[model samples]
Target: MAAKRKSNKKTRKKKKQLIPPAFIVGGIFFVMVLLIILAVINIKVKNLEKDIKLEQSKFNYARQIEKDIKAIFYDLEIDKSFAKHELIKENKKILLKYYLKLNKNEVDTLFYNIGNLLKKEKFKISYFSENELSAENEFIKIVFKVSRFKKSANKTNKEMYLKNKNNNHRLSIIIDDCGNNINLAKKLASIPYPITMSVIPFLKYSKETVKIAKQHNKTVFLHLPMQPKTYPNTDPGKGAIFLNTPKSLIEIIIRKDVEDLGFIEGANNHMGSALTENREKMQQVLNALKKYTDTFIDSHTSTKTVAYNVCKSLKMKCGMNRKFIDNVDDKNYIREKLYEVLSLFEKYNTIIIIGHLKENTIQVLKEELPHLQQKGIKITNIKEVLN
Candidate 1:
């Protein structure tokens, strides 16, 4: 019995060493709490991801609306009537406004076309009035406004049409030797006409003259210097390309003169009476000029000049002055030349006239330009004349 009791005590000790019921219950509860925490964290993460995706979708939708609107405008052909497209920006949306100079029927057609485009894009659209066309979703919105063009109350349609028609006779005038005098060039530039200003390279005010002309929307030209028949006695002055100058040197000199101006649409000879007569020399000059400005206007200093023919062969723009109005520098002669040039308009649509920057010439121009403008003789530029 004593032995049996000792054995029973050992067995009880072994049982105590095994896990307790309270500890098992506590372990199961702890595991359940950890699982609940993990499940809560996972739910919050999934919700955040869904919110981010929804925001990205909204952003993409907004971008798509912009692209769709751009496409709609790109497909439509614009004319003089669609004057202005003004954009007004709100916090996160854009209001597209167009001030159309169109008739009521045209405005209606434009709105109708835009509505059709948005309908295809699956956007819900509504017309606030005949004037407003808009499409909206929860994330993006685009609006287009239309209005019938308003004409000036002062002028009738017939009068405006006639006025436009009368302003047809175009004369391109080139004022030469411009860089010699700053004030004189200023006066020439201030004539309120788009005359071509020809500046002699390396003159005291060459760059300034070019700048002033450009400021006034005038065409600028490099008055290139070249050897004349009386070269030794009558210097063509600085930057003159002589007959003896190698083709490579001639090109370099022409490039410098052109690059110096920074903005000359064309070039004309200062005095190339001898140089122009030589085909090989003129070819070299034209070849050099072709690299800079393909357009060349013969001062018509020498009738033997092959500049025009060379330009034609090269497929370059070419023009020639019909007359040098201020050659004599007499006011009366200049006046007569003006009338003569004006008379040529009867036979030709365009004529080019060349003149010097003289006080008498400036005075004549100031006195006559307004009258010429009144008679619908608009002074154009060399590019227009060449065209």
Candidate 2:
């Protein structure tokens, strides 16, 4: 009986050891579950906090915009004698007209401040302008229409102002490579409206073309030649500046070219596919032009053009060519291009178009320019269109 009891006691002790291991596993599992639950709860709390912070930021921004608007109104009231606002309804659209007896700088600053505030408040903006700031000019008028959402109210039949009835679209045409032919230059100059002539420097008839262009009161531009993609196969002609040319030599050549083509209001690349893409060469060329010309027109021959950016960085009056009018040299194609110009004008309010000195271009311009007046399209100068 004693031997049997001893064996049973040993078996009971083994069972107790198994029980302790099971308890230890259960405790570890509980601890793992608790840690997972705590982590999930912490993530939810962080997300909730982030959402609340975002809402608070939006509210603060709205409050700031309200403050800015109130300040603007207060300033306007203080200067009430010098400014006036009128509301007009046209074709169911509410328009605001602001007439102020302030200089161009003041008007610009006021408009800029309000526009910036509106933008910061996340409002869509469509801006257009007729002219730049002129301090010598008299009172200026500002007009705008705002909408909260893409919703429209009831339509009403109302008589619109005469000025608003006509679309105020302007187009500036530039004839490139003008000095190649003197007769073509004269024909272009006789078109009456402000057609710019971009004369190639050092061409056989360069000086004569400039004289005829100036005599007819047309603006002249130096069609400055530079290295093209097809350098040896297709030359940019005499007095062309190259990418490898030293900066000093580039400046000297540009100055001489401008001198050769006198009475020039601006300068543009003739065939600068390579040089326009070279920032260093373009900067040298534009810097040299600053001494004589008032503006620069980037032909934008290549997609990688740095001319416009360089000009802007230098604070120079610069414009970009929207389209080539006579690239095909066909009369019908040129006419189609001019029609495209009209379409672009409808969208952009202003467009700068370039064409080479081709006979077909001349014919098309002579036929189409007269009808622009009938269409109420203004032929403006290049300088006026430059930003």
Candidate 3:
């Protein structure tokens, strides 16, 4: 019994010595390190969240600036030919250098209008002059230079130039989503304007609409469906290209779509808010387009789109949608959109406006096209756009 009791005491002592002091210290140190790592990861996660929010906010501000610029140009009646934009990237911010050609009166009007607009938008005017205007906010910076308007050297050229200034503005009206509605197509065909019809594949009357448009002397564009940002749920419909789709698969998809459209003169994205942002995917898409069609237009659904850059790199002639007309099905909204279209001519030597082939859209065009023609906006075909 005495031996057993001694053994129990020794066992207790052994149990107490089992964990060395160094081991205890090491365990505490390891726990502290783990906690520090966790804290750092938590902080990084929060920072990432803040970054995402900031990016979204910046995108919103950029869109607002685009609208403000559009409104300003329209109000000033500045010719698009005289206004140009050069993008500069620095420290993750895009600086836009606006080259403007304006008369003294327009310059005066610009300052008065822009000064008020910037102030309302919480921007500070960094610099102001008769020839230059600069403004900045947290997310945006604006600088525009007004150059002297060039005059024709000879009297004959000057006279001719004045006579055809409006005609020089090339406008292409692309009627999108055409295949589903043959009656609308029929109505559009009867219209005198050289309308360009962009038909989506796998629609009820895909080939039939193409035939109709061709018969009516209309230019056809393959309305290439693509994955929008809200994909999987939004579903860009049949024959749409997804970002995850392999390059080889994209080529096959595009080829089949092109062949299905039955000789498209040009192509444009149907709903490519997501796919246009992927540079590699866009390169593949544009290459496929280069095989069958000469021209492509970025649908401009997403501001982050690299489609235009990719298209230029591939040397494929391309354009982008300046604005979407008739997004709302209302006649008044469309009329307002068309009214805005008139002002675009002053800024763009060539631009294409996209609209759906709905009944209301057709009606609005028929009513407003005559007025546009009267005002010297030439309603030309898509081929003329690249020219």
Candidate 4:
């Protein structure tokens, strides 16, 4: 019986050892499976992140392409207007060349859209070419040469009509108060259009403004200061010719003003409300301007201006401002004023528009001047307008 009990205990011990080994093997298998599953999941997450990044990059590229297309469209609109006026009204041939760094599809789209726009505007396309260019680097070069057929009419009548029409319509723009800032004057002069720069005499930048105006082939005028209705409260600045200035003194001041402001083609009152209304005062100023061969422009500061009559009596070449562009210093308002000038152009066939060196005025001119040129409006100097 003692030996039977000992054998049973040994059997129990063996059973316990065998049970532990089985549990250990199962735990090791579970850990291996978990590690393999985690490795697989990590690889999938990495692939998903890369795909998201790629998709984001593609979206950004598409947005940039859209923006570029819109910009190209706007530029084409301006070019089309210019081409139409030159070809249809002026009977001139225009060759426009554009270089763009764009992909093949974008280039093709640009040409197609331009062609359609021009066709819609009744413009006959005389020449068109597009190809990949390698100057400096790879870019797309597009050339468009356009013209219009002249109407069949009696040659004599046609010549007479055209001659009269050309002679009648003229527009002059004068930018005043230019001597205060030389940099602004330089920027205004750099514009590739005929505009008159009326610099205030004896201002801080008066000489520098004239120098830059001449350098850029811009016409310069003396923005002579005269007393305004507001009087001392609205001072026109130093060297102003007031209403109370004596006739002799006025003549001396006028001549000195012209002499000091070298390279000026004409003189226009700066703020001559009171002086312009005083006939005698205005006559003295206009008479002085005659000796210098400098034309006079009545700024028309006062509705009761006698400067115009004085100029006529003195036989001085003169013009009057029909519109002031930046009275409100608002873009929309200035634009409306410009359109008013255009309307005046239709009726009078000649108009002079004056604007200050304000930022809004410059912005409007930079944007709309090209459009004005596109509409067959001539931007001329004060001399041409007066003639």
Candidate 5:
């Protein structure tokens, strides 16, 4: 019986050893679970990095696209109303793609901006549609209309202008210093009215400016540069059409300046402080101008210019600049100049005012010109004033 008791105790000790091995197995399983959890965490961190990189790239691309869109809208606004439809449509496509790819709120804002920009360009929105997609986003479809002017001023003589039924006064604005800026010249050309363009001769852009002016059916004139007191240190251009130049030379220069720009109905002096003061020089210029059956206008840099005398002698159409709109380069000054022109018109029944291609001058003209008719004022071109 003593031997049987000892054997049972040894068997219990063996069972205790088996329990230790089970505990070892459980520790190994715990280590494996820890390794699996670590691997999952690494994979999740790498995925997050990739998502961030992709989003950053998308953001950069969207910013660049937005820049391009804004530039296009600026062109449509500053460029002429006669802008190419294809170009506008192409830009619209790019804008649409970028806006659609953005979130819904961003897309709506883009369309709203576009609409506002178009309104400033004198265009009216016809209709718009938006579609919601599965990405919880929407895309906009925009349609716009360009408003038309009824009886927008074309070229008119005094009689024809007086007979027009449109209430807007006939102010024939002639913009000078045009040849160097083709885009701006073209923009001016597209104004539908008979605004004359006075291009400086021999500029790199002169031919193109003339072509654009012709395309818009606007009159083209040579902004002839005479010897001005302010420009004593500089020559105007090659073969400068100064009043002091000989009659034969003047004719040759004028002919060359008008080279294929089409028929030049008239001309205006650019700066003629020296040329206008010399009666002999004025006579030479007048003689040369007589060949083309065209009119002449003096910029009137000097009050003593012989331009009126020459014009009267030749029986040719003659006009003089009454006011310098942008000489002081202030809005109030320009407005005062315009008001002075209206006052002069009231007194003389016809008057001409000279203006340069400054932004302030354009802005003032746009604001003030529409109200001239209500004040019983008539705005006519230099020719009408002469006749």
Candidate 6:
């Protein structure tokens, strides 16, 4: 019986060694935990994939919308009719970015298109930001650099009427060569307006002429005698600027003539068809007159004369006669020419008409000047026009 008991106990021990209760329980628990973890990981991965697909769809949509808008914009060009369409397209772009967050690829395409469009319309885009969209892409906000063009357009509009209005304007009248007839000069000077007297220096009544002109509140000038082309015998009188005189001598002559005039306001050329064209003579004359503080008017007998250029260089006030109203002294012809001059003034806004104190010219002026002022054409002084 003892041997039987030992054998039974050994069998029991072997059975116990073959099966461990702790290990069996632990294996079952580990398998259950691993299965739960795998299920949770699978669900998370599937959700991630869905989110990626949705984002891709949104990106593709943004791209399509942007392409459509760009096509429409290019078709519209820049016109009044296209303004509303452009605004609509811009709003659409804004909404797309706000709602779905435009794609990176779409955003880049939109920027390129916007830049091209702005360039076509001569505009500049100002607003852009990285956080414009909720996703990896954002919409661009564009504004034009309008201030520069706004000012330019405003000025252009204001000046639109200038070209039309400049065509018809009238200015003052100036009579040159007044020393020959003191009585006639006095009559011309008494015409209720500032008549300019151009007296020959060293003439018999030169001093008396200027005094009488000053007495009548008239402006007087030295009709400085310059060498004429046809007649070297044409004397400019005492201290005249001749072609043969040295430049300094010419300067001294001019200064003396101005001083002889007893503070005259201005001067004009007398028989200077030859001397006026001489650049050297003109430079000396201009320099000499710089001290007297008076202006010069070229009778413009020679088109080749440098008097105009010299006057400009010396910074002197100068006038070019629009026409010689009394070149022939025919009363009817003078009237016609004066009328033409008035028309020219209306057309050009200003005119300088040089005439002599001839009887016919004076008579026509006396009759017509008052009528002209009544007709709304202002007869201003030459100095007024120059200013």
Most accurate candidate by lDDT: 3
Q: Report, for all candidates in order, the number of backbone clashes.
A: 0, 0, 5, 0, 1, 7
1-387, model 5: which lDDT tens digit per residue? 999999999999888877677778999999999999999999999999997786566455445434444554442232333222221222212112322333222332233234323333333333332332111011122332232232226532233434443433345567777777776776676554567788887787887888888888777787776775433333455546665567778888767766644457788876665577788878777777677646887766554568877877888887776656554345775675576454333345556666766566767776777565555555555566674
Q: What RMSD, rounded to one decimal, does every model reach?
A: 23.0, 17.1, 15.4, 17.7, 17.8, 31.0
lDDT of 5 at 180: 79
Clashing pairs in 4: none
Cα lDDT tens digits, model 2, 1-387, are 999999999999988877677788999999999999999999999999997786566545444444554455453332656555564433323334555555322333344335434433445333333222111001112253221122124321111112233457778989888887888888888988899999998889999999998899998899998886545444678889998899899888887898887668888888776789888888888888899976999986654578999999899999888777654445775686576555454347777888878788999999998776677778889988888
TM-score of 6: 0.54
Predicted candidate 6 versus true structure: per-residue lDDT over 1-387, tens digit per residue:
999999999999998898788889999999999999999999999999997786666556555545544453333232323222222224323333222133322332233334323333333223323322111124333332111112235433114334334423555677766666888887888788655777877667778888888888877777777775533323445756778888777777877887777767877777565788788789888778777755888766554567877887788898765666654335765686676554354346667777776788888988988876665556776687663
| 3 or 4, greater by TM-score | 3
TM-score quality measure for candidate 5 = 0.53
After superposing candidate 5, which stretches have Cα over 4 Å from the reference? 1-171, 260-262
Better of 3 and 6 by lDDT: 3
Q: RMSD to the native, candidate 1?
A: 23.0
lDDT of 4 by residue, 157-182 (tens): 22433443454567889999899987
- In order of appearance, the predictions have TM-scores of 0.56, 0.57, 0.58, 0.56, 0.53, 0.54
Between which residue pairs do clashes occur in model 6? 167-347, 168-346, 168-347, 169-345, 169-346, 169-349, 172-380
Q: Which stretches of model 4 miss by more than 4 angstroms?
A: 1-168
Model 1: pairs clashing at backbone N, Cα or C within 3 Å: none
Of the two candidates 1 and 5, the one with more favorable TM-score, higher being better, is: 1
lDDT of 3 by residue, 1-387 (tens): 999999999999999889888998999999999999999999999999998898777767776676667666764467889888764544665566789887643553454345445656777667644366677787778888878655346444324434446777767888888899888889988888888899999899999999998898898899999986544434677888998988899889988897787779888998776789889999988887888987998766665679988988888888887777654455765676666555556577887887888788889999988876775668887777863
Model 5 — which ten-residue stretch has the worst lDDT?
A: 132-141
Hey, what RMSD does candidate 4 come out at?
17.7
- Estimate the lDDT of model 4: 0.66
lDDT of 1 by residue, 1-387 (tens): 999999999999999898888999999999999999999999999999997787667666656555554543443334644646545445554444454455543443344334434544555654444355566555556665656555466664334434454457788888888898999988888988788899999989999999999999998999999886544544788889999999999988998898777878889988776687788888889888987788998776654567677777778898877767654445775675676565456457788888888898988988987877777777777798783
Worst 10 residues of 4 by lDDT: 132-141
lDDT of each: 0.72, 0.69, 0.76, 0.66, 0.58, 0.61
